[model samples]
Target: MDIKKITLFGRKDVKVYSDRPKNIQSILSNHLENLKDKEAIVTEEKTLTYLELDYYSSSIAAYLQKKCDVKKGDRIATIIGNRYHFPLLVFACAKLGAIMVPMNVKLSAEEMEYIINHSKIKVLVSEEKFISKVEDIRRRSTHVIPEEKNVFVIDGKNTFNKLIEPDYPLDSVTVDELDPAYILYTSGTTGRPKGAVITHINVIHSLINYQKIFQTHEDLKTLIAVPMFHVTGLVAQLLHLIYVGGTVYSMERYQNKKYIEYILKYKINFLFNVPTIFIMMSTEEEFKNSHFDFVKKVAFGGSPIYQQTFQMLKESFPNAELHNAYGATETTSPATLMPIKYPKSKVNSVGKPVPVADIKVVKENGEECRVNEIGELFIKGPMVIKEYWNNPEANEKNFTDGYWHSGDIGFMDEDGFVYVRDRKKDMINRGGEKIFSIEVEDVLKSHELITEAAVIGVPDEIYGERVKAFVVGRKLSESSIQKIKEHCQRHLAKYKIPEFFEVVDQLPRNASGKILKNKLKEIGRK
Candidate 1:
């Protein structure tokens, strides 16, 4: 388990140190001591330096300890967006040894209720826009206190402003690195979201991964367009930036034009978002001629990127290093990253396993698959989460022998690069023929007329399941469909060709830009 050095960016070998801070609080305490006046966070409403952030978080921690009686291991949930309040609550929880549970703001009342009750959350904070949703959940869920005093809003009369006591002394608490710092719920494509228990050590390890792989340093300007609820934004962008004393500018929500404007206005040097955001921004008229000289690094994940979009980004940010990263909520943020100076010959790979992590492709019999053989991906490292919150069944099913079963189908090449094929559930079996949806989707996206594509399996009367594609395109004529079919025939097997094609103006996506294949499947059924 001793990691001495890590090779990153193709040639940079960075030393991996074992004597790091035990917890996030210690890390922040160091920053406060040395870089007190450095700007830490910038939002549309206000800016907070390291000193101010420490003061506000400690004040909030005092309020929670006195007013809410929050203690070590208590859960405080928030439905807020990417604002100063979210990070404030997070660090406050760390200081008080409370576990912060950040729920997705886009969830429906029922979904929110399920998570709130499932986690046994005590205090719930939300924004004014989502006040009604929280109210509805409070009525439905017994875990949430159905009183005005317990629920706080961001922009309304019921706010956290009154709880701030800048001069209040913070109670001393011993927090273990192994203690759970946050519980981030997975997207839960198939069922209810399961909270991934991310510990303080996991967060620190992921921060190290970002610092080593991306080569980030202090004073770096980053624009976080992704939601803070997701690991990509929380661990990779926000927390890492804070650890390095960098300035973070957050967007409440993503608008193609507004995102471009922020890049130009803030002179942001580091950009991290989903592939769909980049695709949309590259095609945006405003971004067509926008200068990207300020951008030094661009990192993308959550889903696959089309080859055409990758080429366009290369042309757009000719001076920037483009990285396609792969990880999950369970791994904190990134387990494998495509190197900054990656080989074009291995463009499809998600790069090698990070310094602190190990990856293996295994067959169903628990045996490791040979190189180039497609199988389930298993990841192991300190960065891998120890358990799922209150979900023993999921922990038992997903974790075994110090490795996390990723539930993703992929393979590693002889040179150690990983290429993901598809999620195990998304694979199609048509008349005993296995078809990977990602393969078909990749080929479909290569079509000149198609803007985006998602492939799914529809129930077939005789074949059990058949391939179907949902696409966003300019033309949907019979001739265009025929041309698409012909193109598939040239690139794919006869049985792998999509049996049905649905052309829509846009694909249904979640807040993270992951195509909701379940919604597509429901549409196919109807």
Candidate 2:
């Protein structure tokens, strides 16, 4: 199919097939039977067909319903890696109307405890690799203890060996479009993680947005390279592919060369990743020389894309399209997306809002700002979440007049493309992972030896950026750095861990005693 000629969105003649069912779960189940013999997911050596995915997901959902008492509206947390089973569990949970929460596997025990407790999660299904970590925190916190007696392990011995029979009559439950499908936790820039309650309509809205942005066709084969824990990974990539009956190449880990090899090997059309992944791929000589004949579009987000890097990508993938999408976990992935064709013209813009979503630049006083005026981005539509999970205080402060207050600083041009200036709050994007500096600093300050601490992001080549901690300590040394990190490892995720530590006599502060993080960034640059 000639992708360049495809300008408009949605299917003009979308003959809603007999196989395409009404509900999202039934959509997967129906498609699985329709694509029973067709290849659905491709790994390095294994290709799990639609039939296999259907069987496993059905079995898991059935097991959850019968054994684990995971009825409709119950919240289940998944702390597994990016594997086939992860999506399977996600789909299963969605099918039963259970809210699926995907935990950041790199998070420490204390961090996990905060989310588990805050969300009031029931049962947790994790990989064998992280069994010890999960078990260690299970007894420590009573936040989201399950009423279910048995905690069914994902890749463990008990009940994991059971194969789902196709003959088992699956009772399809009626699900409201507004019902919560998944609760993705955003990195709490101010405090603990806030669970963003994404509904079925929100997911559908996002997929429709993807269809509009990417111009999805029946032949589109997207690669699921991003972690399923993220909304982009689930709604933009996986669910979008399933909705269109397109193939998805799932990977457990993203080794740059190996991902490139798979792109060439399987002839993937759509590739989604962060700026870091694209930067690495662009620098590889082998990748520059390789023929990406079938690869049409490359979508990127989770961090800003530098102009230099964007120009390099244009020079490298001359034939391919690069899309710059912008959204929060609250907006069900992306409310705005830039066209792949006009990279140079729309340099720093995050494109325009998708068809169903409404975007506006608003001042601190809740009034809308004009074009090129920097203000907070406000979004209102089916895609936007109703509220933060169980946090009325946050909802009162963040959301107003039916628009989600995206804590990002950006403005729309005359053409309606958004240019992200900086984060309104101090939310750091180190590599693709989001690390709130304040969150990290709070953890570091918990140490008795540290009098004061401030965290800042410094420029990095591999991870896009790295975190640096500036401290005012009574006893600070190289050894103290390790101690601070060990302390942080207890409360924060691994990516949130500071890569560099600087012990200073006194932290640069304002007259009001506010630590000047900008000064720390400048000092770190030296």
Leading candidate by lDDT: 1
Q: Which number leads on TM-score?
A: 1
In model 2, what lDDT does residue 233 have? Answer: 76
For residues 6-99, write the lDDT of model 1, one tens digit per residue. Answer: 4421212333447667898876787887789988889888899989888899999988887778889988989999888988887899999999
lDDT of candidates 1 onward, in order:
0.85, 0.72
Runs off by more than 4 Å, candidate 2: 1-22, 29-34, 44-46, 142-149, 156-159, 163-168, 340-343, 427-526
> Which residue segments of model 1 deviate by more than 4 Å?
1-17, 146-148, 475-479
- Clash pairs, model 1 backbone: none
Error of 1 at 247 (Å): 1.2
For each candidate, give its TM-score against the true structure: 0.95, 0.76
Q: Compared with the true structure, what per-residue lDDT tens digits does model 2 show for residues 171-221?
A: 666777668888888765356878888878677667767876788765778
Q: Which window of 10 residues has the lowest lDDT sum in candidate 2?
A: 1-10
Residue 349 error, candidate 1, Å: 0.7
